[model samples]
Target: MLTPLVDPDGAPFWEYAAQGELRVQACAGPDCGELRFPPRPCCPHCRSFDSEWRRMSGRGRIWSYVVPHPPLLPAYAAQAPYNAVVVELLDAPRIRLVGNVVAAPDAPLNSVDPARLRIGAGVKVAFTLLDDITVPRWLLERT
Candidate 1:
């Protein structure tokens, strides 16, 4: 599996995930309370350098997704039919995160059947440690 390159601004996010906490970066500006993804040093809304990591509910809906076919990265080729999804957070609708939906936190990439996936489906965050890094994945919510 390919691990994410942790940068300074996004390090805290991975740190929180390691502790089993889901969090998003938010502008800490007094007048601007907006959430931002792909964590940055400055808030795009208020143009303020002040920022904080806000805990999230870890629930979301599948905004968009794709099932990659073979002829991809060597590492992911075995999981060719796996799904890569963009999940819109329930609490912060505008903030969407990318992850794979799996049957369980530590399940294989293709653990969930592709036929069961649907747009707008409810999902919750799940974490698994890979090569010492805890990464977030998703699990379909029972209707």
Candidate 2:
């Protein structure tokens, strides 16, 4: 029961992730160089259509996090107290993405104990299949 964060746009980014690749949108225009996520057809900076997909290293630090403690939808009530984290990718410093981490695809959202989740912790990408989409999750990396 994997729900995808998808849209009419940004489909390609998910497609690549499904293949176990992390990619970002980059500007191909001269001078207005920049990279971004949540893909757009043109550069947000210079509005350039000359953009391409570039792979990322997929390592990041925890920017912020919250542990949800309540009446989660009835379906998820059993998995209450889960931590959702906003991770700032080292490859894309200014941008961040949110996800959960687990040892397996079917692992509960609350699988990563709060005691183990912290701001500034080093994390690496992990993938879990929610139906057909392979969503990116995260895991604390050992020193």
Candidate 3:
């Protein structure tokens, strides 16, 4: 299993996921109100320092995606080919997020056929508890 990489800014997100909730950063700044993804200390728009963690609907479409070729990083060599997708959350228009789409956390890339994935395919976020972090994964969303 590949241990997820986490940072200080993303800690709150994972912490909330551990509680079975999906949270994303939202700018509370008055001037430049916007939703930030991957979590940030300030709004990328106005550079405002005010921000807060807000829950998301966890529903999005596969705007774009890619299947990594063989000989990936040492950590993902076995997972040679897997989907890394950019999902546009329905709840936040400008807020798009990127992550993997695995059948299950423990399964490898080979677990899900790459050809089966398509652009604009609807997907819903799912979290698998790994230790204390809730890494976002995706599953096919019914139309």
Query: All candidates: CA RMSD in angstroms?
Result: 1.0, 1.9, 2.4
Expressed as tens digits, the lDDT of each residue in 48-141 for candidate 3 is 9898888988888888888877645677776667778898888886778888777765555556677778888888888886555667788877
Q: Local error of candidate 3 at 107, Å?
A: 3.9
Q: How many residue pairs collide in each prediction?
A: 0, 0, 0
| Candidate 2 lDDT by residue in tens digits, 40-64 | 7778898889887888899999999
Q: Estimate each model's TM-score.
A: 0.97, 0.89, 0.83
**Cα RMSD for predicted model 2:** 1.9
Ranking by TM-score: 1, 2, 3
- lDDT at residue 36 of model 3 (Cα atoms): 85
* Top TM-score prediction, candidate number: 1
Residue 93, candidate 3: C-alpha displacement in angstroms: 2.9
Q: Residue 69 in model 3: shift from native, Å?
A: 1.8
lDDT of each: 0.93, 0.79, 0.78
Regions of model 3 farther than 4 Å from truth? none
Candidate 2, which ten residues in sequence have the lowest lDDT sum? 101-110
Worst 10 residues of 3 by lDDT: 103-112
Evaluation by lDDT, superior candidate among 1 and 2: 1
